[model samples]
Target chain A: MGLYFVAKRFGVFLVIVWLAATLNFFLPRLSGDDPVANKLMEQASLGGYAQAGIAEMVKVYNQHFGLDKPLLTQYLNYVGNVAHGDLNYSIANYPRTVVDMIAEALPWTVGLLGMTTLVSFALGTFLGALLAWPGAPRWLQWFMPPLWALHAIPFFLLGLVLMWLLAFQFQILPIFGGHSPGAKVGLTVGFVLDVLRHAVLPSLSIVLVSVGGWALAMRGMMVTTMGEDYVTFAEAKGLRSLTIFMRYCMRNAILPQTTALALALGQILSGAVLVEVIFGYPGIGALLFQAIQENDFFVIQGVVFTVIVGLGFATFLLDILYPWLDPRITYRRS
Target chain B: MSETILRVERLRVAYDHPRGVVRAVDDVSFSLRPHERFGLAGESGSGKSTMALAILRMIKRPGRIEGGEVWLGDTALSGLDTDRMRALRLAGIAMVPQGSMNSLNPVVRIRDQIGDALADHGVGLKGRALAERVRDLLAQVGLPPDVARKYPHELSGGMKQRACIAIAICLRPKVIIADEPTSALDVVVQKQVMQTLGRVQQDLGAAIILVGHDMGLMAQFVDRLGIMYAGRLVEVAPIRDIITAPRHPYTRMLIESLPSLEQRGGLRGIPGLAPLLRELPPGCAFHPRCPAATERCRSEKPAVRAMGEDATVACHLA
Candidate 1:
């Protein structure tokens, strides 16, 4: 059943990616400048060519970049390149393949953002369940207002404050970067420790700024689940309060959040571009930002395609797993 | 006389409302005998459910028993803490709640829920023995043995009610309280559920307290009947007397309001709603709505008076 579902969703996923790639090929041309014209403008800006020389330059550039081919033939070649795991060179920046550039930066963003989100989700959900218990302590209820205040604060501002206080004032840790200046990259424990040390400040900031939202969301889920008749029935059946909390309430309360998590998974790969820029993390978000500024169309297309495919896969996996986690759900093909 | 299993004496349950203390159950009392089916018949807001919860100490915030001793055999249930009360409840005295269709967890199989109650008491029954016992319970409730393997959602409304009954009786408790167990089912299904209850009570010989608004059904099944009007027990008598020789005007009206099986239409419902607990009238709560109400009935609340044949009526005329 699981294999069949995965195969079916994969078919749909491929069709969606194909449509998106087709759009990518046509969309840049709609901006009203051919690659030959762009090349001509560059030569004119450098003041190195007269009109006749610029025309010769344009012809050479067009032939080299395959802009001389028919539109349909160029589109087919682009699709074939994508199929062979070949993301061509960035158009306006460094001549690195878009694939290699993204691969180099992908790990830093995923490691930082993924770790923060998982930790925050766990802590927030546990505390929310505790607070929502019927006879929960007053202090926990009192804790909610401050958490809400933190939640209302913007993530960027929170990251700035943490960087100033913990890094600048205390001189406790490095403020930015994926690793310390002298650190080497390898499978060694020393390299891993260096990466962890550098990741601590920005990751902690992200977790603190985001944890309150999840805590508040989970508290709401708990409050709603607490009122469900099954919870009451579980209580009436004489299951211990702790067992009821863990088994009955949490199991159901966590379900709606699962979809949110699936949606967030693709976005996590991009990370916070602003935060990464502020902290100098070598991640996809920073590269994407640079790529946007330079109009690196090939790299941008590759990044967008990867993010979309990641989202589709995450949602597909979640949909397949939901029925196992919650027996109330059953998969039906339309 | 059968041995008395539970005695609720001078029970007064009140809630702290915005308008002061609203007495939801006012000076109501009754005793249940072993194997006797005592039915409390009243419309919504009559405090029938409140009285049952009070017996189990299941009433939480806002609602409280102001004056009462709920005696299960010799042990006072009302004074016990929540842990002990929960232990006694369902293991010693269980309730088959209203809306039985929604009572069971839709995700869980029927056998697991029944096993859960048994497991709560630190009892272990597993493998063939567990399956056999669940099958026996299913058969006892007139359900197919394989029905235990199905989820509650797969079952019909009446089947869910029977599943509820099966779970309730799994402990073999001394008292079983069923609140409006058949209200949501079809006529034929209602008969089957009620008959299943009768059969379970007979087989277990446990004291049964059946709460319902249907007077005719209550008359047919219950050995004793207590009629509640506006949270007070206005009359208690044999089912025959309550149905044929009702003393309180409220009881009489309630009985007359129900249609006989032969009567096709025009069942006269009670003219007014049950008195709101928050702002009850100064005298008898039912006086404004009672057809035979006198001047004194609107001026002073009546007290319970013993009639012959072990019956009691709370009315000025009586």
Candidate 2:
């Protein structure tokens, strides 16, 4: 059973990656203008390529970018280039390859965003469980709504507000960028401390912004699971409240969240794209933003494809892990 | 003389709903002696189930025991906090709930679930002794010892009920409450399950409270019977008296409605639905349906009046 699940999920992963890449190839260019036209318009306004006529400019740009070739040829070559880790040069950053630029920014974003998402989800679930506990303090009822209200506010607004209060006004934390201006990057303890210090505000902003949603979801799930007859039976069996909450209620409650967690894993990658940009963290979201502005098609495609692949892989892992957690699930073809 | 194991005095369980304060169990009281089989017989919405839940302090949101003192031995169940109530459950007063066959965890093997009950109660026995005890419990319920290794879904319905019974009685508490324990089984299987329960009680000397709607089954299995209607016990009597000489008009109708095998006749269902608690008729809740209801019965509620050592009837005429 385990082997079959793993194999099926792997197959799904491949299909999802292929579909994402195919969609990426066309969706960006479908906005009723050719890439060369946008490029010509920009360059013409700058007077760098005004001497060239529209037709001639299109031809020259196409030849330069290998778009002069047939569509099939360009697609096949692009696929080959991707496989060989030879993503083309950025149109905006004429000297930098798409692969190199994304590689430079990927780890920073992943480290900051990934760690924060996990921490916030755990904290929210714990707090929600506590709040849902019978005879919880009256103060918590007053406290939870504001957190939920904060969750409804967009990430960018929250990020800007935090930046204004904590960074701009109070001068309590640094305003922008991933690291301090002169901080050295090395295997030294001082370097690690500087990196963490820089990370603290951005991580906190993202965590506070997202934690309430998880808390609400988990608490709702706990309430529903608590109503299940088995839970009532467990309580009546004279099990300790702590044991009943953890063992029976949590086991059942956490089942539905497994699917949510699977979807969240995919979301966690791109869900904070705006926040990463706002904080000036060197993550993929910021890289993608920069690449899009530069009309670096290769880099944009690479980043999107990579995100899709990561999401696919996470979903694959979810499919395999769920049955282990919930023994009641049986895989059958309909 | 049998020792009194439970005493519910002037018990009333009500729900504070938006419609009104609805009393689901109105001024009900009963006492069960040690080693007695006391059956509570009533149809759905009769409040017998509510009374059972109230006794365990398991009545959830909206429903509250407004006025009552449920004494299990000497501990007042309504007054006990959640922690004490939990400790009292299973170890002090075990229950076999309705649809209990579906209550066993579908994924867990039967033995592990039983072992969990034992372990949670801190029984602390292990190795051959634990295994022997589990096997003995399984055998006592008429299931083969090997069946304990299987999941609930793998077992037949009757076997699942048996497994539930085994789990209920595993700790050997003084009182066992079986709510519709045999309702889901075929007649042959029902008899077998009831007989198994009888053997267990005989061996352990535990007081039993069997709650079901089937008067015939209760009559066959229980020593005393309590008849409930619209959230109140309208009558309480020994099995012989309740079956032979029922006093309440509703009780007489219910007993008369039963189809006797020896008497060749079609069974007659009671004429009207039981009165809703929200819009109970003025005076006696059953007057609207009772064929023998008088003008006074329609105007004033009846109190349960003493009749004999074994019986009490709630009716204006009585």
Best by DockQ: 1
Query: How far is A334's C-alpha from truth in model 2 (Å)?
Result: 6.7
Per-residue alpha-carbon lDDT of candidate 1 for residues B187-260, written as tens digits (9 for 90 to 100): 89999899999999899989899998877789889999998987899899999877888999888888788777
Interface RMSD of each: 2.0, 2.1
| Error in Å for residue A97 of model 1 | 2.0
Name the docking class for model 1.
acceptable
For model 2, the local distance difference test gives 0.81
For residues A1-334, write the lDDT of model 1, one tens digit per residue: 5577667777887887788788877887688666556645775788866766777776776776677899999898989988887777766653578999889888887888878878888877777777777766788888777776877887778888988998899978878788887777887998888788788887877777777777778879998987786776666666666667877788778887777677777678665587788888888778888777666677778877777667767777787778776666765553
**Using alpha carbons, what is the TM-score of model 1?**
0.92
Specify the poorest-scoring 10-residue window by lDDT in model 1 chain A: A34-43
Task: Give stretches of model 1 more than 4 Å off.
Answer: A1-6, A33-67, A92-95, B124-132, B261-266, B308-310
Indicate which candidate wins on TM-score.
1
Task: Give the total clashing residue pairs for model 1.
Answer: 0
